[model samples]
Target: MHKTLDKLYAGIGEAGTGRSGVGELCALAALSANLYTLVCVAPWLDEEYGSAGELRRRIRKVAAALVCRLERETDDLERVRGVNALFVLSNTAAEYEQKMLDLAEPVLGRYEAGRLTAEAALFEAEVCRMMCNCYCLVQDEALAADARTIISGWTAVSPSGTEGLPVGVALARCEAAAAYADYTGDERFRAVRSAGDYGTEEPETICRMLELHLRCGAVSDAEALCDRIEQDAATGTDRTSQVYRLAAKAACELLRIKDAGFSE
Candidate 1:
């Protein structure tokens, strides 16, 4: 498997440069898809069927080579196309993806050049989906940092290309921001509020904003946001089950806290 990946990488490197033919693009795309398959699908087979131990090991090795290839390709794409590094991560396994993210977090700077789009907020949201769903055990510090970078890159427009994200990406960002604040004891609500790139102002996002305001003791502001949320809900725009339910409960708590003067 490692040898197969090596051949693919070599072919891509050779084909990626000084090439203007469909063959080059097709080869690179095949590598991307195959790499994604290995990263995303093989592990599931191993865990469920236990029929591919040796193949899984080779998959791990392929991941290492893929990381290296991503570095060079990201640089090349950054200078030329701005769309290569992420393809390596595009279809990777959730758990393996988490491990790769954890491994790559320290060296993320190396790939920053390749991730230059200003409308990558949705992409970051996808990252959060993987983190919350599969990499629940990952360290918050790394996740928070990645979120900060991705959010900062976003435009203040509605979130774009969010169809592929988890249903709760916005809410997770709120939790991430709050966690970042708690973890570093620093103010980081900016990332939470930077949901413009999501293309849609999800009910969950509004709820998160309200939650953040309430957490910061901004009673009037939170209440005002609640009014906005209610208006949206009444219009049949805001539709989320778990998040809306949770937000309603949180609102009640905030009301009680305000009445009791728990925070002034």
Candidate 2:
């Protein structure tokens, strides 16, 4: 882990010099994602390296560089890749949510003008999903409404026969619906459940569903999902082990809530 952190630090330093290309920008963005996840799951690393705020500033610098280079990028594919990287960074850096949306305006405009390629459309869906998640986190009602509008627009004209596009759209819709439910205190998980299939295999997706169920007073349903997760964990694969660990954490939280007399 130290070696990986060393590499991330070195890469960030090199990318921060303002001489990096689009490829370097994308690589730095990936590094930022890894760093963000590590800091989240193992916060002790912050004491070992630097404060969380410092790490975030370093990453935000890389994101800024990525956006600057993307402006001069002439290749459609590279521009999309750079923009996607920017979105990934923005997703982790919640403080930059509005700035990220502002940066995405031109891309959204192009999408609205019906000029995006298949790949760009997928990227647009991701942008919407990330922004929705960010807005929900901060409880930004106004921006969340704007995100809903963008998502609705995308869904109305979403292309067919494009592999993975439907799944992307489904996840985006789930995020939007989840946000609405949270803000209004109206349990909308049932509607979101019927929105589309968010893959059950992914631990993060399952955790999200578990959260929605608990929030909507579906304790039995949440427990059933936890049981399924435990069964998958019994398979003994490393991935399943990780899933099981997450499931255990969720179960513990559920127990805590129940013990505190917060009945579903």
Please name the candidate that would achieve the greatest lDDT relative to the true structure: 2
Q: What is candidate 2's lDDT per residue for 81-144, written digit by digit as tens?
A: 5665676677666555565555555655665577765565555545554445445545667646
Predictions in order: lDDT: 0.41, 0.54
lDDT of 1 by residue, 1-264 (tens): 344334433433332342222223323333343333433433443342233444344334434444444435533222121122223333442334544454444234433545534234433444433333222344556655655555444323334322244545554455444544544455644345433333334544454455556665667666666555555544323122332333343354335444566454
Candidate with top TM-score is: 2
lDDT of 1: 0.41
Residue 132 displacement (Å), model 2:
4.1
List TM-score per model, in order: 0.34, 0.48
Q: Name the weakest run of 10 consecutive residues (lDDT summed) in model 2.
A: 188-197
